[model samples]
Target: MFSYTGGVVLFAAVLHASWNAMLHGNRDRFLSMTWMSIAIGVVSACVVLYLPLPPKAAWPYIVASGLVHIVYNVSLVRSYRRGDLAQAYPIARGSSPMLVTLGAAIFAHEAIGPLHALGIALISGGIMALALQGGRVSRAGALAALTTGVTIAIYTVIDGIGVRLSDGEALTYTAWMFMFYWLMPVIFVAKRGAPALWSPLTETPMAVGSSLAGGLVSIAAYGIVIWAMQAGAMGAVSALRETSVVFAALIGRVFLQEPVSAKRWLACVVVAAGAVCLGL
Candidate 1:
């Protein structure tokens, strides 16, 4: 079980990074994101038919998280518009752990130690460094990515609380959240009249397949992490999952032809170190 947990965590990390890469590589990020959300909605629709609803106690958190996810998705798209994947991905991914830690301390009365403080400082410093890269990362990109991270931290806390109140049916809660989370993007696209919305899926088999793959991978990544948390050490699982920062950087450089400087590599190391500290 431990070995399986580790493998699952690794695969989840890769999938998480891959989906982000897909979003980054897409020519029309907003459209791609809309399709991805619709894909999630389609899958969730099937699951919610048989799964029990989330407990009433979890509804508020689920709703709040759904709303925050919309902000996250929008910010992510905007960040990718103005920044290279290598730069934006690390800053966004790196920022979340410290913010989540601080949020826990404030909202859940969690204790903070020297290590936690150090981790927060390191993450903040690394993100600041990325933001201050002068011509490398645009201000719009930095702000958008940082905003994405903040939204991620908020939804993560909400999900953590809501899942506990799920009456041993965390999957059901997740399904419902996915369903609700997709609605905003779908509505937005509808309002603007997306004439080419279904063209990619209907006219191009590869597009359909890629969209399905992205959605499945996205769901699988989160689902696997949740399973790993149940079967293994949560801290270890979390730290391992954050290795996606490294993976994202490599993917951007190798696949997307994005320029990753030595300084950015060092920044990634600092970010990963901070994540490790948070886990510890």
Candidate 2:
């Protein structure tokens, strides 16, 4: 299961990067993200109908996760708006694992070994380096990306507990989480002229297709991470999952035409080393 978990999460990293890249490229990120949420909502609602409902004890965590997800989505949109994909993606993805590791050790009572501690340090330092290396990012963008990372850690810890409490039924917990969580964004967009807000998603074929693709991939990536948490330490799972930053940097450089300096490449290598240490 350990090896399988690593493989699954690495695959998820690809999907996570792919969807984020798509979101970063969208001219109207709000509309793109909104439509993506709507698509995921539709799919998750269907999945929830067949899966067993999460236990009552898990409800609070689920609700908490949903609220944190709202902050994460908002921060992510703002981060992308203010910064390039390579800059924002690493800062956001890199910051979460260490936070999750410390949170797990403190709240979850998960013990961290010397190697794990080293891994967390390397990962966090490397990610922050990517963000702070050059004056390539705006102050607002850097703040947003950092905020996004903190939110990711918050929700990850919440969902880790929520899934464990759901009678080992991670899928059911995830389906319900997605079903309810997306409502936050939908409500936000609807308030700003509902018709106008939704037109890009509803009226344009290309936008609709991208939303569907991004939504499905995003759901699959996170769903796999939630599942992996069931069989691994939340911190380790999170660190492994965050290898997405490497893929995101590559995607940004190749597809998005973002600059990828030697410093950025070195940072990605450091993140990989950290992930390997966590797995050890």
Best by TM-score: 2
The model with the greatest lDDT is: 2
Steric overlap count per candidate = 0, 0
TM-score on alpha carbons, each prediction: 0.83, 0.95
Which residue pairs does candidate 2 place in steric collision?
A: none
The reply for model 1, stretches above 4 Å from the true place, is: 1-10, 116-134, 202-205, 225-241, 275-280
Tell me the tens digit of each residue's lDDT in model 2 across 1-280.
2377888998999999999998998887777777788878889888988987789999999888977887787789889999888888888988898889889878888877888777777877787777777787788888899899999999999998788999999988988888765674666656677776657554676976886789899999999999988868888888888888889888988998988899988998898888788778
Error of 1 at 67 (Å): 1.8
* Clashing pairs for predicted structure model 1, backbone only: none
Model 1: per-residue lDDT, tens digit, 1-280? 2255666676888999998888888777777777778788888889999987778998998788878888888888888888877778767876776666666557655555687566556656664564455467776777888888888778766666567677768688788888875674566567666666766766765655665677777877876665454333333444456567667878888999977677877876785676567556
Worst 10 residues of 1 by lDDT: 229-238
